[model samples]
Target: MASAENESLDHVPLFPLNAAVLPGGRIPLQLFEPRYLDMLAGCLREQRGFVVVLLREGSDVGSQAVFYDIGTYVRIVDFQQLDNGLLGITAEGLWKVAVNRSWRAPDGLNLGDAERLPEEPEDVLPSGHSELAAVLRALLRHPVINKLDLSVDFSSAREVGWRLTELLPLDSQEKQRLLEIQDPLQRLDRLSSLLDAMD
Candidate 1:
């Protein structure tokens, strides 16, 4: 494993595996392919975070995945071994970053340099929007999400943003865009639209 100092900073790797990971969100992945299984072993051993950029071009299946200019740096939070010998793992994103450049490593992991996104406007939900409250409340009660935690926090803009971003079933690309957006209120506004559409 590389030195811990090298493990941190902008040395994050890119998987771009047809998925997006929002800040403060968790993503579960199944490691089966030899290349990716090796990548997983590297990360687990090094405690290095990596990127999960969405697959934007070519056939959704069998296409080479590329790192989005923007991505979430995720740390593996849990892991399991399946009957098939594949590694099952869930990762929670710790930060959002912009990919400066990336390439596939000979060892099979996608390696890349990244720049962390600068802090942005507060992601506070617009207050006193009774319509929003009603819509979200109703949305929270949906059969699909009835068992979820839909609680909101007006006190913390980040909390509100995190809850909205993670609870929604948005497309990976859309979620990626939201992750890189700097204006928090704007992010909330976009999230509001997503929630409204769900209702």
Candidate 2:
């Protein structure tokens, strides 16, 4: 995994999905598309990663797919051949980035010039928001989330906010909005409001 200190705004391959993955989160992907398989191969050989952008328009299979400018830079952490013969990979998000330009490669892969966005500084979780951590702890008890074996710091605002954003049953647009917020506390506040509305 590339450390945040070494991240640069260099050209990278883009993986656009209907869902969003924020920094400090992990996602599973199944690769059968030749373009993505090739992209995966290159990333592994280079010891680098690709950016995951939320699709704004069009299908992920075609060249016409459009995505939001903000995205998460992720590194392949684990992989294996699935029983169905597809390649399954687990990727961990490292940080957020902003796409400056994007185009389709000859092999139909989306490539982009992206700049690394600033990460939220570590902030102590406010005492008033302790229930948010309690809520997340309950959510993590689900077998699906439990299998991820996530490492979380309940006292850190950034980790709590990002993890909650990833775990919540929020729509793609709502998740994208949380991902774009620069302040961890503000993000948590927005999440608190959203949670309230859910009830």
Pick the lDDT winner.
Answer: 2
TM-score leader: 2
Root-mean-square deviation per candidate? 4.2, 1.5
**Per-residue lDDT of 55 in model 2:** 85
lDDT digits (tens) for residues 7-117 of candidate 2: 555679999997777777888889999999999999988889999998888988877898899999998889999999999998889889999999889989999999888
**What would the per-residue lDDT of candidate 1 be over residues 1-199, giving only the tens digit for each residue?**
3442345655566766555656656667877767677767778887776777666664223435544677677777778997878788887776777778777666556677877766555544567433444554565676655533334554555655654555567876777677667776676678777766777
Q: What's the true lDDT of residue 41 in model 1?
A: 79
How many pairs of residues in model 2 come into backbone collision? 0
- TM-scores of the models, in the order given: 0.75, 0.94
Candidate 2's C-alpha runs over 4 A off are: 1-4
Candidate 2 root-mean-square deviation in Å: 1.5
| Candidate 1 Cα misplacement greater than 4 A, ranges | 1-11, 59-63, 83-85, 121-124, 129-154
How many steric overlaps are in each model, in order?
Answer: 0, 0
